[model samples]
Target chain A: MTRPDPESRRNPPGAHLGAGGSAYAFLFFPMAILTVFVLAPTIIGLGLSFFEWKGGPLWTGAGGWNLPTFVGLQHYRSLLSDPDIRHGLINTIAFVVGSVPISVLVAFVLAVAVNSPWFRGKALVRTLLFMPTIVSIVAVGFVWRWVLNDSAGILNWFLSLLGYNDPPNWLADGYWPLFWIVVVQIWRQIGFCLVLYLAALQAVSPSLYEAAAIDGATRLGSVRHITWPMVAPMTAFLMVTGVISALQVFDLVFIMTGENETRYTTVLNLEIFREFSYGSFGYAAAIGVLIFVITIAATALQLAAFGTRHPKAAGRAAK
Target chain B: MSREHRRRAANTFNRPPFAVRLASHIVVYTVAATMLIPFLWMVLTSLKTSGEANTPPSLSNLLPATPQWSNYATAWNVGGHVSLLDFYINSFMVAAITTVLAVAHNALAGFAFSKMRFRGKAPLFWATLLTMMLPAQVFFIFAYVLCSWIGYIDNIQALVVPFLASGFGVFYMRQAVTAVPDDLIDAGRVDGMHSFDIFWTIVRPIVWPGITALAIFTFMNSWNSFFWPLLVVDSMKMKTLPLAVADLASAAYFTDYPTTMAAATLLVLPLVILFFFMQRAFTQGIAMTGLKE
Candidate 1:
């Protein structure tokens, strides 16, 4: 309902003095956001990593943490040694490895399918396909949970219809927990990648494809020679964002897995949440710090590849 | 450019050529249908009563056996004590405030980066780019503790304040601002106007479209954010739509699937409406990113 501002007041303050002050004011809001949401928790997490408390600010120091004791790296040792944590870590990796490539592949196929002029109703199909992305992941999790419900659920009904006598416990079973979770994750994330790929595919210069056709090239030849290099940057961007987003994956896992504290889907962040819930603030902080460290290292490698110098060198190598 | 290439490619899929066209259409439609069934299922289930929902397997389950439209009213009423309407209000407020503030900050930052220069600008921009890769969860555990220390924990500020700064928004707006001509600002400068005047008079009006598109996405994000909100929001009073509806879904054990589906439908209404109204902006917003245009 808000109208566009009248010309008089709608204008930015270009003539205003003290660019630094205005800049500071501008920087203030965004920086404050990052400070509160990101930096502060990170600092507090470091302090908490060293101390042990049971559900409170009052540090008993019983765990040998400095608040009263010294439990140097004891939490880390326990976390490492615990088979559950080890299993959860493995599960998290299995999820990342399983979902990321497949989602990317599906997205690419969908993009190509919709991108080609050979098909009618591409608009309807693309919207329908991308529709899942906008739906709440939490909602999607619950819906899929119903679909996968072990008893009286649609999945089992369909499987039995297909002649399998028994459909395993979708949520409770240890076996396909990773599989179902990955399926939902891929479903939710595929839409974003599809949009990205579609954009990237369109950005590809058509003249190159035409030139390739003139050279007696096949569709595969055009994709290999022209399409691949053009969209490589977009692919690179998706990978970097995809990996980071994957490592931080929580909403679907949290909702799908539910309040079973001992569930196998717990990742590093979940471990931190669990530790905090258990009143071992220090240990939780350490786990968070460990996650941050690994993330930083991973992101650095990703950015380094995206850096012009490295890629240029690689391009030189290819030639 | 070459009829021969088209003909040669046609040979692989079809010796007759007309069959490939039909085959492609079949493949595309099949993929589309696979993608749409979940949404189709959600709406169909919403109209059914709790009793019908508890019943297993029936594509025959399409229409409610006994339609209970009252489920919408109850779902709205039962939503984690916050209720659907209230959650919508709270969500709208947070998203609105976040969008307004983020747009203002990014517009200013983008203008400065594009037009004004002091020192270390590229480095500062690069630093912001690097921050984009930060996994938010890595820092949130600490952020929670820090918020608690500052008495911001469980406060709506915890819900809203931290989301206003977005590096990608700034980056995108900066690109848009750069497309604004330097000569336009120069003409204003010759009129004895200052830099701020130039930004207000020339740049902002021109860049408002970009600002608007960014706002929609930002609003969508704020409306749907769960993880951090989950961390801070405990009271029913502060619950957002996703949190409230999710609570309904989680607790409904032998309860009616119809009611849960109704609840889910209501939850998504605001987004669907917003997207429908501004769909042109959203699509144009994405299409702009293709870069070749």
Candidate 2:
């Protein structure tokens, strides 16, 4: 496969799909879509972070356009001091900190459970578990809002049934709002993590377990020593991807939390949407830039941290 | 099953003790029930009257006194500016067109990337990978700016055109295409098939599962999309199902829990139903792609 094809050298880009103009034809639409929609806008967003533009045409004769003016580092400087952005940063962090470990841990356990030899109805249980991950987050968030309504919600009703007369308002009472938001986020995400972990566990070579068994290891010890190490790559992948998605969580927090309650649950993406709505285009772009940076940094930090313990897993995670 | 699949199945060890297996059953089933309760709640609430739905939970309140099957119809006409039917139609059209076009484009590009030799392929593929990691919000903000500048806001094209291709789709389809043997393509070339013809007849049939996965994903993303639609869709007529459902919560109908719940049910039911029929393709696709948004 590595040898260069001499026929192609004579035939000008070969006669397969790589035949000169036809290859470019195959690429044209995807390239144009990526360039115009994804690439150009990404560059424009990065450039817009350094300038103040109220989201309009670049230049015009009669001031109809909101021309961008160079603001240097002012947007970034203000983001450091802005309370809302700070709260958003904190909430975003709180979500990442709260959701990733809990979901990954729960998913790991469930994956182990379902992958066990004695597990029954495996396909049905997996299908039901994975159902939530596929549904619309916005719709589910609305359902959760109904379920968590302070007065008449089913959750508080269930809590009352559990012997607490005064259960905290799941949607509005201070930290409980973010708590439930994080919980729902975990609920929605666990299935995804579960599926990935299941795949990883299924891929583990049974010979490793047999070797551990020959070494006189107990089941628990074998799990800790063999199963855990085998799935480390998937764990790293889940954590990295989980953090990136959790950072941009918008639908749940937006729909579940009330208008004034955004202080507790507003994520960075919500802040971006809010700021964009308020005509602070540059600031919104700056927040997006912040998310982009944090996503990269968090991924790198995870890969590095995982590298120390599981270098092979860390290498795969980087890909 | 394939030999590889059989080997993996053989990896399972002996059954645990009765107590251990029972405990695993309880834990797994309990978590599964917890996952499903909200969906059950959504469907049940949609069938209840406002009075019943508004009250605290009880065994009686759990089931509607008389199922208000017309709540779906009520939610349909409750959209002040546009009916729920319009939203469904809009969402359906946008998702359908976007999925069809995106799958085609992604397959073509994936085949080229995996099999074809061309100039600048390395850099272009790298650029595609770079965009895969970028947060959609970054591109979205500038996309909003660009759309407004080009007067694409409130236009359905804004919804369909931008999403007609994605880096993940192309990258995923590339992986699928990479799994096909080179001998197959060479055989086609030796048979005097044109490049596009070979791609259409040979490469496409081989990578259909990958295409189905990409199509389902693209459709779900487009159908459930809220953020981009929120930004670009100004008029009520252009609102998709998700946007319409979200609006129901903020609209005057917010207190009408049954109707709102019904609308939310309408929004969620299609994908769930589609998923049920296409379960294997959906799950296998995710495992194959090894990533999700």
Candidate 3:
């Protein structure tokens, strides 16, 4: 709704001075940057994925138009055959499935709790819960890695005091590192989702709850019947964005599991980083394209699901 | 009805029971505390000695026996090869310049998209929106190639030039600009004010809060950014704070816990301070845009 309709706003020609020229002038720089850095690279990245190149010029020709280095579908075919790449892709999917739902659910619960009319310290709680989202991921990753250290970690030390003789290695043991990575990701994500949910929650009309109460609805009944449906748009938004981010997770996983090269914790972006570092440019671009395809597909699927159920909400989301 | 009576009528009658409210409070506080634990531990470890940092945690040993204030100094100048100060300077310069330029470019483009008529307006706006949705990962591979082609692989320009504009910034500012009343713009035009001048003097002030919010978000994002810097920055001299802190933590020769903690704390300190000062605008910025960097 904040987007003004361009067609309806057409004034008579020459009624506005400096409008036409300045519009182009204003758009020139950002659009140029986007065209070169974002638009062109995406097209080029797709092209690069089909060809084999290692850290240098694309082809041995006058312009890169010659098809000497072209290897059609080779990188994509290799991706299908490669075990490590498949595992990395599966890990990313699992990460998205594991983290996105839990984060959105937990954030909704917290937002609902803190948005209660009688809730004390709402602002304080909001501030505290939202802190982690704004901080440096590397710093937080290091702190968690230290706190979850096998022998010297505060977690194990706390576990020992609580009458447990053995606490599993959180970062080193099989599956535990992946599990903790998901947990840390959820911890980081809850705040942003919570803030969005809180904003959505505040916009709900109190009169609806009052009306439900008068109709013999309990607090739980009211929330289930009214509040849940109302925040569907926010939930949809959170899920799409959350899945997109969860699929591309790198910095935290890299920081936590880089020392061990844990197979379970390796996600798509990490694999992409590794390929790029190894000078496998075409293969890396192939993986990048895979991530893009998955991201677009997931976004489209969510929008379709939401559109069927909440058409207006889905329309907003499409923006 | 009196005003107070009207307000009382607006209150919902489905308030939870005392026990239920108490339980909800406990759950909320627990989650909030969970969010604070890592930060508190980071600060605590930074002040402790290496021996104390690695020591078993207990009620008595929670605080450092005597805070080692010098760990920060040690962390700042780790080895002849790596220095946190250099990383700090690199991060500040890049983030500051990027923030200023991004605000101007995004605002101007936002104004154009929102109010001005031009050729390719609809398609251009759609492309901008598409850029907002597309993950930055999609472009990284070829962006690297392009940067290298332009002879900027290891240069600081790699950090700033390609990233001087953002789809989110443009979109957010478009919303802000759209909210400005048409009368103000029309009046400025009547007085023969140029579009740029009107944007600067009239519209900018109206959306100053939004601008500040955008600026804060841009700064924090640039400061904390890792992936691009990781790709382009091959030398220690060009490393940003995130890269420097990650390197420091994972360095093969480095097992100094307190110093590592100190370095982590220093990396996170600026934004933490900035958040406390601009918490309102910052959170509002996130809520307004419904996006995170």
Candidate 4:
């Protein structure tokens, strides 16, 4: 038995459906763009993290890529030891972990509620749920910052009416900065999650619910057993995407948290921003690399345990 | 399955169901209000004078006491270097060019992936999906890099280039293409149509609506895009709506409420209008993607 050439089989020169080899170039566009924008830059980014780049133009290399300089372990060392980066990592994790569950659960309940007849003006409700999702994050963050302002802000004004003297220093205190960031993140995201959950719940078969009802399940019971399992894939997707987004959560955090200080409100993106803003390209890139590593590890662990929305064999097996 | 279970089920669902439903109505309405109030605030605030804006937002101020329509004009003209018209021009041109290129590339590649027997096709598609999972984090420098390499960074193309062949577009369009009957291609061939002709004259229209939805999404994303433009293009001359509006808001010392409102309202109105018109296509197109793939 002759072994087929694996290389030729995979690359079959100028391969096509019928016109053979004529369509081979079609692959080049998508593949080339990927190489240029994604693969090549990523490889370059991996290398640059080791060097000390004085951010000017990427090519001019104000320069530092050496071994004692290469300190095979130094980039990793700096990433771990940096207080701001460390705080950012923790904040990012907390933000994701905190938001994902609340958003997903609230959204799921809202979707189920909307799917029922008791919810009148469903159209208006849906539009309301979707508005924040469509609005720019900057707008949402900025507006909410005003509303959540410590003194003379809307929340505090209400608190004053309630006879409270003080409200939280939302963007100021180290603790509440983290708290406010989470609040904004969840506030902006809950609507989006609700929409996705609604869409998923819309796909749930009524027959299944009816069967659950006939089987003597309470409304809540059916929700727990029937609805929950059916929406698991979406829940998992929300979780994964939530985790992934939370890891890189930048915009609202940057805008809402105001600026970086000992507030420990900085995340990886902010850390990178600090580096880049101060012309510490390599150091920022190092932070980015760490983020990339964490993302991969986290996502892999998630996929291993939670079976993603990818309905292919891997997902099926994971389930 | 049992008599006891049946009795319990009947009692639970049948008892005070009207009251339960009424309570649900109140609960859902409150939840819905949470989502809707912000936009109501946006509209109300747009009508407000600078004085109203500093004070807490309230429904009583929903309609500005003395409605000032001039604020919109102020926003339009405040950044005199480029007016709303210029931003509109920039937005349309960028969105139009990006949508066309992205849809075209997606169509061709999606067609190939769906129909053609390419080497490593599965792996290639998988790689594309993987790219979608990669965070938008690393993209901070994509525009800058592409520009320095091609000297197009500050140019309008900077806004249009990097996203031209979107991964999700390809994934979606490929799902649409595979549903096209092979016999249709054979019939086209039997009618003496060229393959390119078949794709253009036959397949394009069938997928045109699907492509139209993709175009709108691409357009919206490109139109509202902030970060990439913030990094790549530094000049006020090339500002898109989001960038210009954000600048207007941030630069306002007294939080130039009226002008900023006008700019934001102008920027968002077209989208709101566009969304309403194509809302059905947009929703159906989105719905179909999940169903298909």
lDDT of 1 by residue, B51-143 (tens): 676677666764677767888887888855456888878788888898898888878778877776545667767756655655564466666
Which candidate should be chosen as best, given TM-score against the real structure? 2
Which model is ahead, 3 or 4, in terms of DockQ?
Answer: 3
Writing each residue's lDDT as its tens digit, candidate 4 over A41-152 gives: 6666666677765534534455643221343557778777777877888877887788778887887887777767445677677666656655666566556665665532
Worst 10 residues of 2 chain A by lDDT: A310-319
How high is the DockQ of candidate 2?
A: 0.61
Give fnat for candidates 1, 2 and onward, in order.
0.40, 0.63, 0.63, 0.18
Q: TM-score each candidate.
A: 0.85, 0.94, 0.93, 0.85
Q: Which regions of candidate 4 are displaced past 4 Å?
A: A1-22, A55-71, A150-152, A157-165, A258-262, A308-319, B1-16, B56-62, B139-143, B253-255, B290-293
Measured with C-alpha atoms, the lDDT of residue B176 in candidate 1 is: 91
Tens-digit lDDT track of model 4 for B68-133: 788887878777766878878887899889888888888877877876665678888897777665
Q: Distance (Å) between predicted and true CA of B122, model 2?
A: 0.9
Query: Which residue ranges in model 2 land beyond 4 Å of their true spot?
Result: A1-16, A64-66, A259-261, A311-319, B1-13, B252-254
TM-score of chain B alone in model 3:
0.94
RMSD (Cα, Å) for all candidates, in order, is: 6.5, 3.2, 3.9, 6.3
> Which tens-of-lDDT digit does each residue in A194-265 have in candidate 3?
999998987877767656766777777666667877889889899988888787888888888854555777
Q: Candidate 2 overall Cα lDDT vs. reference?
A: 0.84
Ranking, DockQ, top scorer first: 3, 2, 1, 4
The runs of at least 3 residues in candidate 1 whose Cα sits more than 4 Å from the true structure, single-residue gaps closed, are: A1-20, A43-48, A51-72, A160-165, A261-263, A296-319, B1-16, B79-82, B119-127, B283-293
